[model samples]
Target chain A: MEHLDALENQSIYILREAYKKFKKLAMLWSIGKDSTVLLWLARKAFFGHCPIPLVHIDTSYKIPAMIAFRDQLAREWSLRLIVGQNTAALADGMGPERGRLTCCTALKTEGLQLLMAERGFTGLILGIRRDEEGTRAKERYFSPRDKHFEWNYKDQPPELWDQFKTDFDADTHIRIHPLLHWTEIDVWEYIRREAIPIIDLYFAKDGERYRSLGCWPCTGRVKSNAATVEEIIAELRATNTSERAGRAQDHEDTYAMQKLRAKGYM
Target chain B: MATDIATPRASSNIVIVGHVDHGKSTLVGRLFYDTDSLPEGRYAAVARVCEETGKPFEFAFLLDALEEERDQGITIDTARARFHTARRDYVLIDAPGHKEFLKNMVSGAAAADAALLLIDAAEGVQEQSRRHGYLLHLLGIRQVVVVINKMDLVGYRQRAFADVRRAYLDFLAALGVHPQAVVPVSAREGDNIAAASARMPWYDGPTVVEALDAFAARPSREHLPLRFPVQDVYKFDHRRIIAGRVEAGAIAEGDTILFTPSGHRGVVKSIERWHPSRTGPARAGESIGITLTEQLFIERGEVISHLADAPRAGAELRANLFWLGDRHLAPGRPYVLKLATQEVPCAAAGVSGVINTATLEHVAAHEVAKNEVATVTLALKTPVAYDCFTDIVETGRFVLVDGYDVAGGGIVLPPVEDDYTI
Candidate 1:
C-alpha cells in the first residue's frame, strides 16, 4: 500500500536525519519487531550497510532466545553490535525482586548511561513510539537529554512542521526516535510486508504468546494462537489489547513509566 | 467515512484538538482501536496500571497512560498516535484541551498538517474551541476539518449538529479560517468515525475518516527558494559534519551553500547519514549530513544552503507570535530564540501593537497574557539564516526560550518597516 510505503519513506528519512545530525552515534536494538525493523531501515538508509554501532542492552535477564537471536542477526547482517550492561549493579544483585522500577533503572537506563560515558557516544537512536505510552507522547523526534540524562518534560522545544530541533549545548547529548510516529500494528504489518526477521516469542506457541518482550522474570504471556505472521495480522486486525500490557515496569504505577523516563530510562 | 486519498510522497502530520471532555483523546483512542493499530497486550499494560493506580480501565488508556493524566482525567502533554487509511499515513496528535495546558496544545498544533477541530454537540461551540481555532490560524495551519462530536448524546439530532456547525463557522471566520468541511459524529458511540452512522444519514458531509482520507498533502514553499536550518555541526575525529533537515527545496554536492546569521559561506563537499565514509546529495524532508568543501566554525540553528538562493541574514525580524508564558512580553527583555538548531539570546525589539486574536484588531498599550497572539519584533544578538514567513515558512519559524524553557512560538512577518534602528 502507498501508506505503508509513505511510512517507510518517512522513517527512512528520519533515520537519515539522525545519521546526518550526530557524529558519534549508535542504534538501540531491543531484538523486538520494532527495533529490528529499525535496524533494517538503518541499513537501507545507509545503502545496505549499517554504519552505526548496534547497541543491545544486555540486562542479563533477557529471555535466552532473545540473546541468541541478537547474536544470530549480528552475524548474518554483519552488525557492529555493542552489548552494554550494568555490571556493577548486576553484580550487586539488582533484580526485579527488589522492584520493577529499580530493576529497569539499573539494568536498562544505567546500562545505557554507563555505555554512553565509557564509549563517548553523543547520540542514541531508539525505536520508541509516541502511541506506546503517554510519557513518550512528549518526546521530540530529535529530543535532547541533559548531561545527567534527565528529561525536562515540561520544557520542550517547539517542533513546528518537520523542522525538529537538532542542535544542543555542550555535554547535552540527544536521543533520536525515528519511529516515534509509528504504531504497534504498523511495525508488524511492515514486518509481514518486508519479511523482516523476528524472535520466536512474538508468534504464539501452545496457545500462548509473548506480545511484548522484556526481562524473562517480569514478562507475561497472553492467550493467542496466531502462529504465523499472517494469522498474527488477522488476530491484530481484531484485538483491543495494548502491545505493552504484559510488561511489568509500565504497570507499577500510573506514572511509573513517566517517572522512569524523566530520569532517562527508556 | 472511507475516502482514502492517494499520496505519492512523504505523508503529513495532522493533530486533532478540542476542549477537555470534548473527545480529543477519545477520538484518537477510537481511531487506534478501530484501525487495530493498538499493539498486543497494550490494553493489559493499562489495565494493570489502572488496577495499580485504582483508575478505570478503558480506551483512554491508549492516550492518557501517564499517571498525572489518569488521575486528573485530563491530557497534560501532547500524545501522538498513528492511523493509516488506504491512501496515506496520518500522525494523529492528541493535544490537551484544558486552559491550564494551552502550551501543550500549541506545541501539538505546531506540528500538524491539517486540524480536526472537535466541538461538543451539546455544548455548542465553547471558548476553548474558538481559542484553539484562533491558535491554529496563528500557527498557519491552513486546512481544518471540524467535527461536531457527541451527536449520540444529543440523540443524533440534526438541529444540534447544525447549531454547533453554524456557531463554529462564525467563530472560525472571525479567526480567518474557512475550514474545508464540518462533520457530526459521536466518538463515544463509535458513530461516523470509521463507519457511516445510520442515525446521521440526513448529514451529507464526509465522516471523520473520509475527511482525513480525502485531504491532499499541502506542498511547502519549496519552489520559492532554499532554506536549511542547521541543527548542529558535528566535529568527530576532526571531520566536520553540518547536519540538519532541508526545510525547503534540495541540496546537491558542490552547490555553494551559505550559513545565515553567521554570514559564513562554504561549498557543499559531501552529504552523509551516520558515517564519514558514506555520502550523497540530500533533499527536502530528509536529514542528511554535509561536509563543507571549505570548513569554518559553523554552529547549530544557522541556515545553510545554496548561495544562489540564500535567505536574508538579519538580527531583527518582524514576526507574528503566540505567547504561552505567564509573564508579559515587552521590548528590551531578552528571551531565547531558536531557529532550527540555533538558540541565541534575543530581545523583543518592539511591542508593535498587540492584536486580539479573536477579532484581529490591533490594541494599544496592553500586555499579552498567556495564549495571546500578537505581532512583535525580535532582535537577536547574533545573526540567523531566516526568511519572511509569508515568503518561505522554513526559516521563518522559531521558538522563544526563557531560562531553559520554550516560552512561545513565532512566525516571521514581513521585514520590519524602513524606519527602525536596533
Candidate 2:
C-alpha cells in the first residue's frame, strides 16, 4: 500500500488546500466508491470530521440502494448532507427517453447549477480521476467555471508545480479534483487498505457487477465474479475493460462526457 | 497470497518536451503502443476513425482527444498516460511544445522525476529545445534522456544525430544540466524506441525505453530535516489536531517542533491517522495530524520543523522565476506571493536581469514579460520559512498571484538572508 500512501498524502494535501482557500465550499458525493473514498479522505483531512457540506444531485433515477447507503453513512458520520434535484424538470417528464444528454444536462448539470446559485458556494470538491475518461485528463486540479457554469477547457489558466488556480473572480466557481491523479485500480486498492465502506452494488451479485455506478435506467453491469474488494483489485489489474464500460451515458457517443462536462456536469 | 506481501512497483513521473511538431505526442503514443498499454479497443477505435475519415493511421491521434486539438493537429494541453515496463511504472506526461503552450510545458515538467528532451534530428536544435532544457533545469529535473527524434527525416545518419546531440549537450551545459544520456529515435519509424535501430549500427546506446528504465529514481529525503508546512488546524470536539503533510524527514511522538514566522514551539503528543490501523512515526509525504502537548498560537501557512535545524524565516529574499502572465511583471506593484501554504503581499523590489529563455542571455530589464526568466528581489509583508530550490523543492518554490491568477512562478535563491537591499 505504499503507492496508496503517496496518493492519500497528495489527496489530503489538495483537500486541505481547498478547505483553506475557499470560504463557502461543498463536496459532491455520488454515493459511489470514488466519492465515498473522497469523503473518508475529507474526514481524515479535517481530523475525523468533515466540516464541508456534502452535495448530492439526486437525478430521481438513482438505484434505491445508493440512497440507502448515502443516508446510512450520513447518519453514522454526522455529515452535513445536502441533496439537490431538478424538480421542475423531473415533473416536466425529463428522462432518458428525451435524449440522454438533454436529460443529464437538465437533471445533473442544471440541478447542480441551481444548487450553487442558491447556496452561493464558490468551490466544489469532486471525485473525478483522469484515467476514467479522455476529457477528464485535460482538467486542472482547480478548474474554473464561469458565471453560467461553462467550462472553458480550451483557454485554461496556467497551473504549474503545486501552484493551483485558487483565486477566481466573483462570478467564477472552481471545481476541486483531489483524485485526478489516481486510477481505478488505485481507488480500489486504497479502499481495501483503508477499509472504506462502499455500496455493495460494485460487488458481483449474479455473474455481473456495476463497474461504474449511475442512474439505474442508464447504468449497466459487466460480467464478473469479483465478490470481494481484493478480488475486484485483482480483476482490475488483469482486465482491460474500461472502468466506465458499464456506464451507458459515456458510451452514448464518443464525446458525450465532454459535452456533458462542458455544461458543468460533475 | 505472496502478491499481497510484494512491494508496490516504483513509479516515476516522466515528461516529454520538444519543439512544436517535433513528434512529442507521436513518441508518447508509440511508447504506449509498443508497451501494449492502451486499453482494450482504444487503438482499434482510433484506427477505425482514421479509416472512416480516409486518413492514414497516426499514433498522435491516440492522444489528441480534444476536438480543437484533433482538428488543428497540435496538442494544447498536457496528456498523461500510464506505461508499465518490467522494471517500473511510468506516468508519461506529454507536454505541448508550442511556444505559446510554455505554461502547459511547465505544468508538466514541474511534476516530473525525469525528462525526455526530444529534438528533431532533421531540424537540429530549435528554440524550444533550448527553452525546455532551461525549464527542466529550473524545475529541478536533473535526470534527463535527450531524445533526438526524426532519424528517418535525416536518413538515420549518425552524423546528424551527433550534431544535434552535441549542440543540445552544449546548451544543457550552459544551464548547468548534465543529462544522463543522449538517445536517437524515430517515433514514426519506431527506430531506437522499443528496440535498437538496425539502420544506425554505428550508434550504440540504450533505446528510449531502456534509457527510461535505467533512469534513477529520486532518493527518499527522510534523513533530511523535517519540514511540515501547516496546512490547517482542526478542532474536532476539543481534540485539536494540527494537520499537514510531512514534506521532508520524519516526525514522531514527543518530538519538539517549532512553527516558523509565529515562533511558537510545542511537543507532539501523538500522531493521528484516520485509519486506526496506522500508528507510530510519520515519514515524508504523509499527510497526518498531530495533537500538541500545548495549544500554542499556531495557524496555517507556517512551517513546523525540528528546532535544531529550522528553516530560515525572512521578509526579503532573492529568487529566480519565470513569468507566464500576459502582463509584464514590474516592480512597485504588490502581488500575492504564495509559498507552501503561506500567502503574503509582496512586490518586486528590484529586477536584476531577465534571461531570454531561448538564447540563455542575460539582459537588463525593468519588467519580465511572458516566457521570460528573471532574478528579482522580493519584499514580503510577512516573514516566511523557506529553503533554496536546490535544498528542498517543497518549501523552496512559490507562485505570484496577480488579480486572481497565477502570473508567475519561481524558486527561492540559496543562503536566505534578511539583508536584501535593492
Candidate 3:
C-alpha cells in the first residue's frame, strides 16, 4: 500500500506539473492499461476533472473492443477526445504487411505527429514505463521531442531531483511520462487498487490472453488461465516473459524499439 | 477490479556508481542473475545476441541496451532494472562514471535512496572513486555500501581489499559519509554477491545482497511541519481549487495556513479529492486540491505552511551548486532559478570555494565549468520562500535553467560569514 502511495503521489505530482507548466498540453490515450491509469491519475490531480485534452492516434488497426472502451470512457468521464489518423498512409495501404517498423512509424508515430502539428500541442503526456522495454529504461520523466518529432536519445538533458526540463524551444514538444518509474506489476496493481475499468482483452478467455495490446495483427496472446485482475496479478508475479514479448514489432530486430522510439513512436 | 496486489512489497532504489570499467553494470547483472530476478530467457537472449555478433558474452550487455553503447563499450546514460530479494524489491540504477556523463550520473544518483559505490581492488582508489563519493554526499544519499570489486584479479588477497577500502573510506569520512558496510567481492566471478564466497575466508562481514538488505527505507515526512508549494490555481467550474502536493506534514479543513514571501494567511475551507468517500486530511506525499476561506491573490511558487513555522523568505541565497552546462557558470550571466515551483531570473553574485571533484582541490576561480563543484551566492530577481537544505530538502533544492535547458542543480546553504564544510 505504501509503495502504491509513493508511485501514485509521484505520478500525480508530474501530472500537476504538466498542467501548471504547459498552456497547450494534451495526453496520449492508447486505451491500454497504462494510459487508462494515467487518465485516472489526471482526474485525481485535477480533482475529478481532466483538464488536459486526450489525443488518441487511430492506427485503424486497434481492436474494436478497445475503440468501444475508449469512447465509452470519454463520454462517461466528460473527457475531451482528439482522434488522429493517417488517412493518406492508410489509403496507400500502409500496414504490418508492409513491415512492422514501417507500419508503426507511418500509422502510429506519423499519425501522432500529424495530430500534434494540427492541434499545436506543445507538450504531450505518455504512459511509457521503463520496466516494459530495454530502450525505455533510459527515458527521462520530461523528455523533449524535436520539431520533426524525433527523440534525441543520444544527448538527453540531465534531470535531477523533482526538477525537469520544463523550458524548451517553442517549436519543440516535451513528452511527459508520469509512469516512467513504474513496472508492469505496479500498473496492474494500481488498476486493481483503484478499481479502474479496463478492456476485456487483457483478461484470459479460453486459456489465452493478450498481455500487451497493440495493433491486432502484430499483437499475440499468451497462454494463461488468469481471468480476473487478481489472477492476472498472480500470473504476472509467476511469469518470466517480458511484457512486450507478445508484441511482434519489438522482436523485428534487436534495437527495433530504440529505432522506433527515436523516430517518436510511443 | 480488486483493491490491491497480494503482498505489497517495499521497493528501494539503489544506484551503482564507480569509475569507468569498474564493473558497475556487471555487478548489477550478476546481482540480478544470482537472485533469479532476470526474466526468463533474458540471459539466453543476450547470449544469442553475442553469438550473432561473434563477440564474447559479457554481463554488462544485459543492461547496455543501446547498440551504440555496446559498440562503444561504455554506458552513455543511466539504465534502470528491477530485481527482487526476499525482504524487498530493488531498482538497480547503473550510472556511468565517466566525467563526460556526470549529469547522467547525478540524474541517477538523485533518485536513489541508497547507493553502492564500487571500487576496483586491482586499481586501488582512482579519481572517480573519490569524485563519486563526494557526489553521493552532495546528493544526500546517506545509506551507501562500498563494494570492492575484482577480488579475483588480486587472488582474493586481504591486503589488496584493505588498501582500496582504507583509501576510499578515508576520502568519504572527510565528506561526512558513513557507508553502511564495505563488502569485498568479484562481480565477474560472482564472489560474495548473493552467496558467501569460499575464496575469501578472511571476510565474514556480509555479502553485497546482505548489505543491501540491511538498508532501511527513509521515513515519510508526515510528522514535519507543513510545506506545500502551491503548483497552480484552477477554476474548472465555479469553485477555485488550489492544487499542489503536500511536501511535508498534513493539512485538513479549518487549518490556518500562511503563504510565505507574500505573507497571506487564509483558513482552509475544504479538502478536495476525486473520490468523495476517501475524504480525510491530505498528508505528505499526496497531490490534493483545497479551497480557502478567502480568495487571496495566490500564484504558483507560494510555499504554504503553518504561520508559526513558515520558511525563510529572501532574494539572496547561498548555495553549493554543481555545474553541468556546456557553458561555464560565471557571474553577470542571467539564468532562471527554479526552486520548488518558483522560477525567477537570477545571477551568480560571486563564485568562491570551487573544488575540482576529481582532485578534491580548491581552485581560486570566478566561474565554474561543467562537472565541477562550487559554492556560489545567487542573487534572485525576486524574493522566494525556502529553508536550508538541512531543514527541508523539498524547499531548499533548486536547478538553474540557462536559455531553455536545465544547466545545474544545487542545495541551499545557511548564510554564514566564514566558509565551512557540511
Candidate 4:
C-alpha cells in the first residue's frame, strides 16, 4: 500500500545521487508519459529547475504534436534542450517504409548514438521500466552501455541493495534507469497524482489515443475514451494488455527487443 | 485459498526453483494458465509441438522450447513469466535447478522478492534442492516457501510431506534461509495449484497462492541515514538537477547532502517528489531529481548523503563472494568492480578466504572455484562509496565484471562477526 511513496522516494533519491555522481551527464527524453514524468522529477529534484541537458533524439518522423509539445515545455521550463538526429540516414531515404526494426535503429538508436558521440556524453538517463519488457526486467538501475553502445543483456551484474555497477572503462557510457522499478500503471497513477503535463496524443482525439508513444509512422493508436490520466490508470488496472502494445519492433520476433538492445538500440 | 483482494498491485518477483524434472516450469505454467496471464493462444501451439515431437503435453511446455531443452526435457536459461493474484502481480522467474545452469539460477534468484522452492514428494530432496537453497541463502534471499510437489504420487500423504519438510529445513538452516511455510501440491493432475486439493484434508495451511499473498513484504526503513545513488544529473538553462532513488530514509528542504567517491557537498535547496505541477516533500522509491545548494563534483553512481551522517568509509571492503562466472576468481586479477552506478577497476587482492557454502564454515582457501561461495577482501584502484551489504543491501551489494560480462556478484556482509557464518 505504501509502495507508491516508497517508489517516489527512491526515484527522488536516485535523481539526487546521479546529480552528485557524474559530472558530464545528460538525460534521454522520449516525450512519453514516463520520461516526461522523469522530466517532472528532474524539476522536483532540482527544485523547479532542470539543470542537465534534456536530449531528445529527433527521428524527424515523430508526431508533429510531440515536437510542438516538446518545444513548448522546453521553453516553459527553460530546459537546455538538445535535438539529436541521424540526418544522413534520413537523406538516404530510410523510413518505417523499409522495416520497423531498421527504421527504429537508424533513427532512435543510431541517431542517439551519433549524438552521444558528438557531444561526448558519458552518462545518459532513461525512463525505461523493468515491467515494460522481459529483457528490461533483468536490467540494473545503473546499467552500462559499452563503447559500441551494446547492452549485453544476458550477462548483467548483480545489483544487491542499491549498489549499482556504475563505473565502466573510458568511452563506455552508463545508462541510468531510475524508473526501472516502476510499472506502467504506476506511471499513469503518478501522472495523475503529479498532474504532469503530457501531449494531447495520450488523450482520445476522435476516439483513438496513443497508448504508447513512438515514431509517428510506427506508433499505433488504441481505442479508448480514457480522456484523463485517472481514466488511463483505471483502464490499465482492468486489463492485462502489454504497455508496449503500440511499439512495432518488439513484435517482429520473440526476442527482437533483446536483439535490438544488444545492437545498442535503446 | 483465493481472495479477490487487490492492494494497489505493486510488483513482486517470485523465482520458481526445483530439481530437474521436478516440474518447476510446469508449476509456473499452470499458474500462468490458471491466472489467465498467458499470451492467449500460445498454449495450443505448445500442445501441437508436444504432439509433433512425441513429447507429452504438459505445463512445462510453456517455455520457448529450445532445441536442447526439447531434447532433454529440461529448462536451460532462467525463463520468466508473469501472473497476477488478486492481491498483487507476480513476475515469476523460472530457474533451472540443474548444476550446469547454476549461473542462470543465481541470476534469477538475485531479482526475486521471495522464492518458491519446489521439491518433488516422490524424489524427496535432491542435490539441486540443497544447492539452490544454499545459493539463495548466500545471495541473501530471506523469504522462502517450500512446495512439496507431486503430492498425488504419494496421495498427498501427511507423513511423507512432514519427512521431506523436516529434512529440507535442516538443509535450509545450514544455508541460513528458513522456510516460512510448507505447502503440499502436485504440479500434474491439477492438485492444489490454483485451487486447494481434496486429498489433503488433515493439513491446514494457506495454499501456494494464499501463502504468496500472506508472504511478508520487505519493510522499508525511513530512519536510516539518507543514502541516494546519483543516477543522472540534468542541467537545464541555469539550474542543475540531481536525480536518484532513495535507498533508505527521507529528505526534505535545507537538508545538507554530500556526494561520495566524488566527495561533493551541498544543501538541499528544495524537496520535490516526482509531481511536476505541485512540488512537495519526497519519500523513498520515487525516481525524482534534487537541487543542491552549490554545484559539486556530482555524477552517476556515487552515493549522496546528508552531511550529518557519513556511511562507513572504506575504499577496501571485505565481501561475501558468490562466483557465477565461467572463469575462476583469483587474487591480483584485475576486473571491474561495480557499486551503485560507479564502476572501477578492482583486484581480488588477498583472497583472505572462501566460505564452504555446504557447511557455512570458513575454509581458509585462496583459490575460488566457479559456482562456489567465498569470503574475500577486495581492493579497488579507485575508492568508491559503499556500505556493508547488511547495513544497506541496496548500496552495499556489488557485481564484478570481467571484460564486458558480469562475472560475479557479492554482498558486503557485515564485517564477519567472529569469522563464523552460515
Candidate 5:
C-alpha cells in the first residue's frame, strides 16, 4: 500500500502539472480500468471536480456493456464526456475484415486525430503504463507529436528530474502520461487501495476474463478464474503472461504496436 | 503474493551506469533472470526470436526493445526493470553509457536512490566510469556500489579486481563520492551475480544482489522545513484550493505558510482531498490541496514554505551544472532555468571553469560545451526561493531549457558574499 501511495502521489503531481501547463487539455477515457483510474485521479487532483473534458473514441465495435458503463459513470461522477467517431470511415465499410491495422488507423487513430483538430485540443492526458508494452517504455511523461501526429521516438527530448518540457512549438500536440512509471500490478493495487470502480469484464466469468479491453473484434479473452479483484491480483502475481496478451493488434507483428504508435495510435 | 496478505516492501530506484558495452544491460538482465523477475513468456519469446534469427541468446537482448537497438546491439535509452529481494524491491534503470546518450543517462540517474557504477575489470577505469561517478555525486546519489564486471575476461583474478577497484575509488574520491562497496562479477558467466562464485577463491565478498540489498534507503525529509512548490490553484465551485506536492516537511490546518517571490502569506484553512478518508496533515511526497484563510494572488511557480524558516530568495545564483545541449552555453545568452515548480529566464553572468569529465581536470572556459560540466554564476530575471543542494535537494536542483528542450541540469551552490571560486 505504501508503494501504491507513492505511485498515487506521483501520478497526481503529473496530473496537476498537465492541468497547469496546457490551456486546451482533455483526457482520453477508454472505459477500461486504467483510464477509469486516471479519471479518478483527475477528480482527486481537482478535489472532487474535473474541469477538463474526457474524450472517448468510439469505434462502434466496443462491447455494449462498455458504453453503458461509461455513460453510467459519467452521470454518477458528473463527467463532461465527449464521444468521437470516424463516421465516414465507419460508413465506408471499415472493420477488422479490412486489415486490422488499417481498420484501427481509420476508426481509432484518425478519429481521435480529427476530433482533436476540430476541438483545437493542444494536449491529451493518457493512461499508458510502461510495463504494459515495449514501445510504451520509450515514452516520455510529456511526449510531443508533430502537426501530423507522428511520434519521433528516436530523438525524444531529454527529460530530467521533475522538470518536464511543457512548452511546444506551434501545431504540436503533446501526450501527457501520468501512469508511465507504474506497472500493471501497481495499477491493480492502486485501484484496490482507492476502491475505484472498474468494468466487470475484468473479473472472470465462465472461466475467462479480459486482461485488457479494446475493440470487441480485435480484443480476446484469457482463461482465468479470478472472480474478484483480490483473486485477480493473486492471479497476476502468479502468472508470467504479459498483460496485453489478449490484445490482437500487438501480436499481429513484432513491430505492430510500434508502427501504430508512430502513426499516433493511443 | 496474495493481495490481501502481502505487505508492500520498501522500494528503491537504482541506476546502472558505465561506458558503452561495459555490460550494464547484461548485468541488469542477469539480475532479473537470477531474481525471477521476468514476466511469463518474456524470456521464451526473446529466445524464440534468437532461434529464428540464428543468433545466440543474449542477456542484453532482454532490455534492447527497439528494433534499432536490437539490430545495433546497444542500449539507446534508459530501460526500466523491476526486481525484488527479501528486503526490498528495486526499479533498475539501465542507462545507456555512450557519450551521445548522456541526456538519457541523466534522465535515468536523476531519479535513482542508489547507483551501480559498472567497470570492466580487464579495461579498468574508462572515461564514462569517471563521468558517471561525477554525475552520481552531482545528482545527490550518495549510496553507490562500484560493480567490477566481466571478471571472466580477467581469469577471475583478485589482482585485476583490486586494481580496477582502486582506480575507480581514486576517481570517485576526486568527485567526493564514497561508494558503499566495490563488487566483482561476470554478468555473462553468472558468477558472483546471484550466488558467490567458486571461481574466485581469493575474493570473498557479498554478491551483487547482496550489495544492492545492503544499500541504505534515503532518509525521509519529514523533519526538514516545509517547502511546497505551488503547481496550480484550482477553484472547485466556490472553494479555492492551492494544489502542490509537499516537497519536504508537513502542512496542517492553521499553519501559517509564506509564498516566495511574491511575498504573500496566509494561514492554512483546511486540507482538501476528494476522498474524505485523509483528514490529517499532508507530509512530504503527498500531493494535496489546501484552502488558505486569506485570499492571496498565488500562482504556479511559487514555493510555499513555513513562515518560521522560509527559503532564501535571490536573483543571482552560483551553480555547478552538466551541459547536454548541442549548442554551447555561453554568457549573455538567455535560457529558462526551471527549479522545483519555478521557471525563470536566466543568463550566464560568469563562468568560472569547466571540468573535463575524462580527466577530472579544470579548464578555463567562457562557455560550457555539450557534455561538459562547469561552475557558473547566473542572473535571474526575478528572485526565487531556493536552498543549497546539500541542504534541501528539491529546492536546490534545477534544469536549464534551451528552445523548449532540456539542455542542462545543475545544483545551487551555497550562498557566498564575495568569493566565486569552485
Candidate 6:
C-alpha cells in the first residue's frame, strides 16, 4: 500500500505541476494500461475533472476493441477528447506493407506532430516507463524536444531533484512523463489497487492475452490465463516475460526503440 | 495471502555509485541475477547478443541496454532496474562512475532513498570514489551501505576488505556519512552477494542482499511543521479551489493556513476531493485542493504553513551547491532560482570553499567549474519563503536555472553572518 501510495502521490504531484505550468497542455492516451492509469491520476489530481485535453492519434489500424474502449471511456468520463489521424497518409494507402518504422513515423509520430502544430499544444504528457525500454531508461521526467521534435538524448539537460526543465524557448516542445518511475509490475499492481478499468483484451481469452497493446497489425499476444487484474499481478510476479514481449515493433532491430523515441515516437 | 500477492510491497530506490572499473555494474548485475530478477528471455537475449559479437558473456553485459554502451563495454548513463526480495522490492539505480558522467550520477543519486557505495578491494580507494561519497553527503543521502567489491581478486581475504573499508569509512565519516553496513562482495564470483560467502570465514556480517533490506525508507514527514506550497488556483464551476501538495504536515478543514512572503492568511473552508464527498485531513504527499473561508489573492510560489511556524523569508541565503553546467558558476552571474514553486532571478553573491571532490581539498577559486561541488551564497532579487534543508527538505532544496537548463542544485543552509559582495 505504501508503495502504491508513493507512486500515486508522486504522479499526482507531477500532473498538478504540469497542469499549473503549461497553459496549452494535453495528455496522450494510447488506450493502454499505463496511459489509462495516467488518465485516472489526472482526474484524481483535478478532483474528478480532467482539466487537460486528451489527445489520441488514431492510426485507424488499431484493433476495433481499442477504439470501442476509447469511445466508451470518452463518453462515460465526459473527457475532452481530441482524436487526430494521418488522414493523408492513410489516404495514400500507407500500411504495414510499408516499412514498420516509416509507417509508425508517418502515422504516429508525424501524426502527433501535425496534431501539435494544429492545436499549438506546448506541453504533452505521456505515460512512458523507464523499465519498458533502454532508451526510455535514460529519460528525464520533464524532457524537452527541439523545434524539429527530436529528443536530444546525447546531451540532455541535467534534471536534479524535483526541479525539472520546465522553461524552454517558445518553439521548444516539452514532454512530461509522470509515470517514468513506475515499473511494468507496478502498473499492474496499481491497476489492481485502484481497480481502474482497462480494455478486456488484456485479459486472457482462450489461452491468449495482449501483454502490451498497440496498433492491430503490429501487435501480438502471448499465451496467458490472466483473466483478471489479480491474476495478471500473480502472472507478472511468477513469469519472466518482459511486458513488451508481445509488442512487435520493438523486435525489428536492436535499437528500434531508441531510434523510434529519438524521432519522437512516444 | 491473495491480497498480499495482489498488492505490491513497499519499495526503495537504492543507488550504486563508485569509481569507474570498480565493479558497480557487475555488482548490480549480480544482485539481479542472484535474486532471479532478470527475466529469462532477457538473460538469454543478452547472451545471444554476446555470442553474435564473439565476446564472452559477462554479468555487466546484462545491463548494457544501449548498443553504443555495449560496444564500449561501459555504462555511460544512469539506468534503473527492479529486483525484489521476500521483504520488499528495490529499484536499483546503476550510476556511471566515470568523471565525465558525474551529472548522470547526481541525477540518479538525487532520487534515491539510500545508496550503496562500492569500492574495489584490490585497488583500494580511488579518486572518483571519494568524489561520489562527497556528492552523496552533499545530496543529503543519509543511508549508505559500503560494498568492497572484487574481493575474489584479492583471494577473498578479510585484510583487503578491512583496509579499503577503514579508509573509505574515515573519509565518509568526515562528511558525516556513517554507512549502515560495510559489505565484502565479489560480484563476479558471487561471493557475499545473495548470501554470506563461505570463503570469508574470518568475516562475519550480513550479505549484500540482507544489508539492502535493512536500509529503511525515508522517514515520514507527516509530523513535521506544515509547508504546503500553493501550486495553482482553479475555479471549477463556482467554487474557488486552491491546489497544492502537502509537502511536510497535514491540513484539515477549519485549519488556518498562512501563505508566506505575501503575509496573507485564510481558514480552510472545505477539503476538496474528486468524489466531493470524501472529506478528510490531507497528509504529506497528498495532492489536494481546498476552498478557503476567505478568497485570498495568493499567487503561485508562496509557501503555505502555520503562521506560528512559517519558513524563513529573506532575499539571501547560503547553500551547499553542486554545479553541473558547462559554464563556470561565478559571482554576479544572473540565474533563475527555483525553490519549491517559487522562481526568481538570483546571482551568486559569493562562491567560496570550492572543493576538489577528488582530493577532498578546498581549492581557491572564484568560480565553480563543471561537475564541481562548492558552497555558495545566493542573492535573490526579492524575498521568498524557505526552510533549512536540514529541517524540511521539500521546501529547502532548490535548483539554479541557467537559460532553460537546470545547471545546479543545492540545499538551503543556515544564513551566514558575513556579508556577500554583490
Query: Candidate 4, residues A1-266: lDDT per residue as tens digits?
Result: 25465566666666666666677899999988889988887776666667789999899888888899999999988899999989999999989889888888889889999999999988889998866765665566777888889976545554544545555789788888888778777788777666778888998878889988988777899888889876777777666567787777777865577678877776
Chain B TM, cand. 3: 0.97
What would the per-residue lDDT of candidate 6 be over residues B1-422, giving only the tens digit for each residue? 12368346777899999999999888988999989888767888778778888888877777768777788877887889888887778889999888887888899999999999999999999998999998888888899999998888998887778889999999887777889999998899899999888999887888999999998867899999998898888886787888888899889989987889999989999988774223588888877888998888989899989878889999997998989899999998889999998999999999878988877788899899998888888999999899988899998899999988888998888886544211
| Tens digits of lDDT, candidate 1, A99-180 | 9999998899989999999998888999998767778877888788899999887666655545455667878888889888
lDDT of 2 by residue, A75-164 (tens): 999999999999999999999999888988999999999999999999999999988877898889999999989999877888876678
Fnat of every candidate, listed in order = 0.38, 0.58, 0.71, 0.26, 0.69, 0.70
Task: Estimate, for each residue in B1-422, the C-alpha lDDT of model 1 and write its tens digit.
Answer: 22312222245688888988898888888877776656666666667767877767666777886666777788877877666776666778888888888987887888788999999998877778877888888777889999998898899988888888998898787666889889898887788888888998898878788899877777744465667777655554466776666668878888887777677788888766642222365556655667878768876667776778778877787877878887877677778887766667999877777766545567884456677777787889977667777677767788887654566788876684754211
Tell me how far the alpha carbon of residue A159 in candidate 1 is from the true structure, in angstroms, after superposition. 4.6
> On a 0 to 1 DockQ scale, where is model 5?
0.70
Model 4 has fnat of: 0.26
lDDT per residue for candidate 3 within B1-422, as digits (tens), equals 12235657778999999999999989999999999889987898889888888889888989999888888778889999999887778999999978789889999999999999999999988888888888888888899999999999999999999988988888888788899899999999999999999999999999999999999987688888899999999898888999898998889999999998999999999998785325689888888888999888999999999988899999998998889999999999999999988999999999977998766789999999998889999999999999888888888899999999999999999977655555
lDDT of each: 0.78, 0.88, 0.90, 0.76, 0.88, 0.87
Which wins on TM-score, candidate 2 or candidate 4? 2
- Can you tell me the CAPRI class of model 4? incorrect
In Å, residue B349's CA in model 3 sits off its true spot by 0.4
lDDT of 5 by residue, B99-148 (tens): 88899888888889999999999888888888888888888889999899
Error (Å) of candidate 3 at residue B98 is 1.3
Runs in model 2 with CA error above 4 Å? B1-7, B415-422
lDDT of 3: 0.90
Which model, 3 or 4, shows the larger TM-score?
A: 3
Judge candidate 3 at residue B290 and give its lDDT: 89
Of models 3 and 6, which has the larger lDDT? 3
Flag regions of model 5 displaced more than 4 Å.
B1-6, B417-422
lDDT of 3 by residue, A1-266 (tens): 27888898899899989988899999999999999999999988887889899999999999999999999999999999999999999999998999999999999999999888888899999999999888899999999999988888778899987888888997899999999999988899888888999999999999999899998999999999999999999888888888988899999988898999999989
Report the TM-score measured on chain A for model 6. Answer: 0.98
Candidate numbers sorted by DockQ from highest down: 5, 3, 6, 2, 1, 4
Error of 1 at B53 (Å): 8.5
As for lDDT, the candidate ahead, 1 or 2, is 2
CAPRI class assigned to model 6: medium
